[model samples]
Target: MRIYISADMEGVTGLVDRDDVQPGGRDYERGRRMMALDVNAAVRGAVAAGASDVLVNDAHGPMRNLLPEDLHPAARLIRGRPKQMGMLEGLVAAHDAMICVGYHARAGALGVLSHSFMGHEIEDMWLDGRPVGETGLAQATAAAIGVPVVALTGDDVACAEATDWDPSITAVAVKYATDRFAAELRPEDDARQAIEDAVSAALAAPLAVPEPAAGPAVLEVRWQSASVPATLAGLPGVTATDSRTVRAEGELPALYRQFGVWMRVATALTNQPPYC
Candidate 1:
C-alpha cells in the first residue's frame, strides 16, 4: 500500500504553544524532533502492516519542521511551500490510504495549539457552508481524490471531531485539550502506542471515506481582519462576504485552488517581522 501522511506539529505529543513550532524559539528544535519521532513511529506501524510506499508531508509552519536525516528511510517526503493543494498535495488517486498525523482542532477549540488554517489570522473556515477545522477540511479534500483517510492522531477534541465527521477512520487521541495553549497530555510512549495501534487497525480494515460534497463547492473563510479577502478579490474571483467572511465558488479542486491563493494573501497581510 502507498500511504500519504500529512504531518502537522501542533497536535504532536507535548506540544502546547506557538513557540514550540516556530523556528529560533527556545523549544522549536526539541518540538520538531518529537514531531519527527511521532511521524517515524507511524511509519513504522504502516510498514509493519504491509505498506510498501509512504510519502510524508511536512504540513506545518514554514513546512520545514522535520529533519530529513531523522526521517524513516522507507518514506518519501513532500516538503515545500505554496503547494497546489497545500496540506493535501501528495495525496492522489495512486495512494492506497492516508494517515493524518499530529493534527489539532479549529482555532477556538480546546486543543493544544488548535487552529483551522492560519490560526489567529483566520477566525474560522467552512466547506460547503459547514464549519470545519483543519482535520475535516483536509480530509474532505483527500476524499475528492478517492483516497481513504485511514488513521488520524491528535488531541481528544480533534479525534472527537473526526469521529462525528468520519467515524470509520481510525483515531489516536493523544491529549486532552484544556485550551488552545494547554492540554492534559499523555506521555510520548503512550501516545506512540496509540498511534501504532490505530495504524495497525486502519491497515487491517481500511475504511472508505464517506462521499465528499460533490462539485460546485462553496468556500468561505472568516478572518480575524475583514481586509484579508478584500485583497483576495484582487487574486481573481475571491470576494469579500460582509466584513469578516470571504467567499469563493467552484468545484472542490478549483475552490481550494482559489482558497489557497486567498490564504497566501491573508498570511502575507498578517505576517509580522521579528522587530514587530
Candidate 2:
C-alpha cells in the first residue's frame, strides 16, 4: 500500500512554543530535528505495515521545516511552499492512507501552539457549515480524494479533535496541553514509540476510503483583518460574508486550493507574527 504523511511542527514532541517551530528562533533547529524524528517514527511504522511507498509532506509554515537528509530513507519528501494544497500537498486518491504528524488544534483552542492555517490572521473556518481546523479540513480533503486518514500524532487536544472528526482514525498524543504554549510533554522516546505503534496498528487494518463528495463544498473563513476579506472578495466565486469574513463555493480539492490562494493574499496584506 502507498502511504502519505503530512508533518507539521507545533504539536511535535516537546515543542510548546513558536520559538521551537519558527525559523530563527533559538530552538528552531532542535525543533526541526524533533519534527523529523516524529515523522521518521511514522515512516518506520508505515513500512512495517506493508507500505510499498511513503511520501512525506513538510506541512508547516514556510513548508521547509523537514530536511530531506533527516527523514527516513524509505520515505520521499515533499518540501517547500506555494503548494496548491498547502498542508495536504502531495496527497492524491492513489495513496492508500494519509497520516498527520505533529498537528495542533484549531485556532483559539488550548492546545499547544494552536492556530488554523495562519497564526492569527485566520480567526475561524467552516467547511460545509461545520467548524473545522487543520485536522477536519485535511480529513475532508483526503476523503474527497477517496483516501482515508488512518492515524494522527499530536498533543492531547489535537488527538481529541481528530477523534471527534472521525473516530476511526488512531490519534497518539505526545503532550497534554496546559495552555497555548505550555504543555506537559512525554519523554521523547516514549512519544516516538507511541507514534510508531499507533501508526502501525492503524495502517495494519486501515479504514475504507470514503466516497468522493459529489456535491459542491463551501469554505468560509473569518479573518482577523477586514482588508483580507475585502481583498479576497475580488476573486471569482468568493463572497464577502461580512467585514472580516469571506465565503467560497466549489468542489473539494479545488475549494481547498482556492483557500490556499486566499491565505497567500492575506499573508501579503498582513504583517503580524503568528500566535500574536
Candidate 3:
C-alpha cells in the first residue's frame, strides 16, 4: 500500500518556539533532527506494516526542515514549499492512507507553536463550519483524494483536536501542553517508541475515508489585522468582515484553495514578525 506522511516541525518533541522552526537560528538544526527522528520512526512502522511505498513531505518553513540523509533510506522525501498541493504535496489517488507527523493546532489554538498555513493568515479555518487546524486542512486534501488520515502524533492537544476531525485514526500524544508555548516532554526514547507504536496501530486498522463534506464550506477567518480582509474580499465570492476578519462561504476545495491564496497574500502584506 502507498502511504503519505506529512511532516511539520512545530509539534516535534523538545521544540518550544520560533527559533527552533526558522532557518537561521541556533535551535533550528537540532530541532530539525528531532523532527527527522520522529519521521524515521513512522517510516520504520510503515515498513513493518507492509506498506510498499512511503512518501515524506517536509511541510515546515522553507519546506526543507528534515535532513534527507537522516530520513529512512527506504522512504522517498518531498521537500521545499509553495507547491500546488502545499503541505499535502506528494499525495495522490494512489495513496492508500495519510499520516500527519509533528502537526500542531492552528494559530490561536491552545497547542505548542500553533499556527495555520501561515502564522497570521489563517486565523482559523472551519470546514462546513467545523473548526479545523492545518492538520485538518491536510486531512481535507487527503479526503479529496479518497485517502484517510490513519495516524497522527504530537502533544496532547493535537491528538485531541484530531479526534474531532479524524476520530478513527490512531493518536499518539508524546507530550502534554503546559500552555500554547510550552509542553511537558517525554523522554527521547519514549517519544520515539510512542510514534512507532501509533503508526503500527494506524496501519493495522485504517479508517474508512469519509466524504470530505462537499462544501458549501464556509471558512471564517479572524486575522490579526483588518486591511487584508479588504484586499481578500476582492476575490469572487469572498467576503470581508466589517473590520478584522474574512469569510468565504459557499466554497469548495478548489475555490477554497484560491481563497487561501488571498489569505496568504494578506498575511505576507501584514507580516511584522515576532507576533507584532
Candidate 4:
C-alpha cells in the first residue's frame, strides 16, 4: 500500500509557540528537528504496516521546514511551496491512505499555535456549511481523491477536532492544550511512540474511503481583513459573502486548490504575522 504523510510543525511533540515553528524564532531549529522526528515515527509506522511506498509532505509554513537529510530513509519528501494542493500536495487517489502528523486546531481554537491556513488573516472557514479547519479540509480533500485519512497526530484539541470530523480516524495526541501557545507536553520519546503505534494500528486495519460528494462543495471563509475578501472576489466562481468574507463553489481538490489561491491573495494584501 502507498501512504502519504502531511507533516505540520505546530502540533509536533513539544512545540507550543510561534517561536517554536517560525523560521527566525529562537527555538525554530530545535522545533524542526522535533517535527522530523514525529514524521519519522509516522514513516516507521507506515512501513511496519506493509506500506510499499511512503511520501512525506512538509505542510507547514514555508513548506521547507523538513530537512531531506532528517527524514526516514523509507520515505520520500515533498518540500517547498506554490504547490497547487498546499498541505495536501502530492496526495492522489493512487495512495491507499494519508496520515496527518503534527497538525494543530482551527483558527481561534485553544490548541497550541492554533490558526487556519493563513494564521490571523483567516478568521474562520466552512466546508459545506460545517465549521472546518486544517484537519477537516485535508481529510475532506484526501477523501475526494479516494484516499482515506487513516490516522492523525497532534495535541488533545486537534485530536478531538479530528474525531469530530471523522471518528474512524485514529488520533494520537502528543500534548494537552492549556492555551494557544502553551500545553502540557508528553515526553518526546513517549509521544513519538504513541504516534508510531497509532499509525501502525490504523493502517493495519481495514481502511474506509468515503464517497466523494455528488455535487459541488461550498467553501466560505471569514477573513480578518476586508481587503482579502474584496480581492478574492475577483477570482472566477468566488463571491463576496460580506465585507470580510467570501464564498465559492467547486469540486473537491479543485475547491481545495481554489482556497490556496485565496490564501495567496490574502498574503499579498496583509502584513500580519501568523501568530499576531
Give me the candidate number with maximum TM-score.
4
| Candidate 4 stretches greater than 4 Å from native | none
Q: Give the 10-residue window scoring lowest on summed lDDT in candidate 2.
A: 205-214
Write the number of the candidate with greater TM-score, choosing between 1 and 4: 4
Order of quality (TM-score): 4, 2, 1, 3
Residue-level lDDT of model 3, residues 66-89, one tens digit each, is: 878999998999888576667777
Relative to the unseen true structure, what is the C-alpha lDDT of residue 26 in candidate 3, on a scale of 0 to 100? Answer: 82
Pick by lDDT: 1 or 4, better one: 4
- Please tell me which model should have the higher TM-score, number 3 or number 4: 4
Tell me each candidate's RMSD, in Å, in order: 2.2, 0.9, 1.9, 0.7
Q: In model 1, where do residues sit more than 4 Å from their true spots?
A: 207-210, 272-276
Badly placed stretches (over 4 Å) of model 3 are 249-252, 274-276
- What local lDDT score does residue 16 receive in model 3, on the 0 to 100 scale? 77
Error of 1 at 143 (Å): 0.6
Cα lDDT of candidate 1 equals 0.81
Cα deviation of 142 in candidate 3 (Å)?
1.7
Candidate 3 lowest-lDDT run of ten: 251-260
TM-score, candidate number 3: 0.92
Cα deviation at 215, candidate 3, in Å, is 4.4
Q: lDDT scores for all predictions? A: 0.81, 0.92, 0.79, 0.92
lDDT, model 4: 0.92
